[model samples]
Target: MTVSSSTECVIVKYEGRIATVMLNRPAVLNALDEATLKELLYKLKEVAGSAVDVVVLCGNGRGFSAGGDIKSMLSSSDESKFLPIMNTISELVVTLYTMPKLVISAIHGPTAGLGLSLALAADYVIADTSSVIAMNFIGIALIPDGGGHFFLQNRVGTTAAKQIIWEGKRMTADEALKAGVVDEVVAQDFPKAVREKAEAWLQKPIKAMVQTKQILCEGNKQSLLQVLELEKEGQFRMRATADHKEGIAAFLEKRIPVFQGK
Candidate 1:
């Protein structure tokens, strides 16, 4: 069943087989405060296990995200309070990383710190030209967490990833695309552009798409032989799906397939 979360900090909107998870703290550029982070974790878990064909993770307001609330983090001395938020960040990132549903990070505005982490973790990241992105953890004297190391390394090579982290400079959408961070960079009208991309994914065989996402994500840490075994199992699983049969039939008939994600 399609489910949506209506929490204060995060808005989970489900429609047309897509769950759009928007970070709602626009005033501070959707800063990752404790409450917002907790709500995000809850919503991500809710969608991760749901039957939604795709998830579009975006931020509401001027930018995609600013990562953390720098002021609150700098002033706070309470480990009890701060640590839980950090832990929740870990959970949210992991959920996005391992989820079977296809996730697309629709970015606009300034995405920095762990915000970049979250975006990189997604299966597809599409941003408009207005977006500015950076690792920027060095500014706070902190290392990149939230799977930043893993995701960035996966996209760019280790050398480039290390250079990016060390430089800690913001990059334009074009530069990001060159770095292999932003999958597609459109002009203005990001809302429409992003939705169009998601809707296009909706037209394909979603179950197989999700299974492919799983195989690729796990392939990162797995050996070549192990990945081959995974591919064998995955191929078998996809072959048994009704969508697969429909796909084969459609190809044979030279017609478009109507996939129900079965």
Candidate 2:
């Protein structure tokens, strides 16, 4: 069943116990603009309250997502416009992370910046071999938001997480898997692999699995919340930086950015 119309930025389809939530702005590589983020949050809440046992988060078109909309960022010059966007992202991340059902991120092509954070929120992440993953906010003189700090630290520990964030390097699927950034990497037939994995999960005692997830997530919930708050404030600071202005200018000009320690 179709939960969202084609015109929506996010679309939801249900089949049996599985609900697939797809990011729908293929023209711009599904970049998360304010409307897209809000629609996603609403759809997630709807799915969370439904009878579905599993949620598969994926993107339509060439790539999973390129991250936040750079165009939107350019437009949000003031706190009044920016903070609401960040808050929506925070709420969406929290909802996905705390979802009662099993959540799987089916990643393909470029998944960077805030997109990586959203993918990490899932209980399991399956990446196609073509996928390139990055915590790339540093390149834009910004920091990762959407609980990136908490999730990256949880997956690869603090030291590696900090290094990855600072470098903002892109990693291939195998590299990401080796670094413990992704759960599984599929070289071929990515969609089939995701389906098989989800079906296999369905065969297990899913309720008990969800219970364990709830316990662990609940126990560490405060840490994630704290990180989100820090990211929100830090992002605002970064937005005001000279380096950030240079980064945006360089991006628009399709050139390299020269950042000065300001």
Candidate 3:
């Protein structure tokens, strides 16, 4: 079955166990306005509540996103009107980053500012070789928001993250890949790569994958002992699932396991 979300700037389509999320405002390179940001958050929440095993996030047009809408910002003078929208964006970053379902970002064209934040928050990021990537807040006399600092620093280390944000240069896909910003750089056929990756992951034990993701996402903040304890607890829980039994049986039988996400 296939279903599309009724959102203004964001589109969500679910097929089988996979949900594809698209940032759909093509005219401004998918630049997010207040309505768009709220819609994206709502869609993410809906996806999290559903039974989707994996999520693939991408933009609908030539660019992923140009970040927050500058026009909106420029027009608004009252901090009250603006701060709520900014808060929404932050919530969006947190939702995408910590979602139980494994999230993959397919980036192309110009991705910068909060747009890059959204991509980095995902579990995996795949970009086209010709894509322009940046942390571009410096150009606007602003700093990276929407957890951009945390994501960049986590991926590429502190110094590089700082430099990337400070310089605010448009980075080539090769440069971004070398910096460990994105997981894969596809020379061509960006959509094909995303589909292949989503299909591959969907075949595995999804519940186990989500459990592993939870532990790993919290790994940095915890001590080794705490991480080990989580691993132990997680292992204990996973051991009792139906998927685990199927996996063991498949291994003994030398056949593929069919995981039902139980």
* lDDT (Cα atoms) of all candidates against the true structure: 0.78, 0.93, 0.79
Candidate 2 lDDT over residue span 96-165, tens digit each = 9999999999999999999999999999999999998999999889999999989999999999999999
> Residue-wise lDDT of candidate 3 within 72-145, one digit each (tens)?
65566464665577567767876787799999999999898889988988999999886899987654345577
Error of 2 at 47 (Å): 0.2
TM-score of each: 0.79, 0.97, 0.80
Candidate 1 clash figure, as a count: 0
RMSDs, each prediction? Answer: 18.0, 2.1, 18.3
Candidates 1 and 2 compared by TM-score, better number: 2
Off by over 4 Å in 3: 1-7, 219-262
What's the lDDT of the predicted structure labeled candidate 2? Answer: 0.93
User: Which parts of model 1 have CA positions greater than 4 angstroms off?
Assistant: 1-7, 221-262
Cα lDDT of model 1 by residue, 1-262, tens digit: 1123334788888896899999987878888887888888898999987878889999887888998776566466564664466566666776887788989999888999888988988889998898899998654334576667777777898899999987889999999999998899998677889889999988999888888878876776344224334433443355457776675566467786686777
- lDDT at 193 for candidate 3? 87
By lDDT, rank the candidates, best first: 2, 3, 1
Model 1's alpha-carbon lDDT is: 0.78
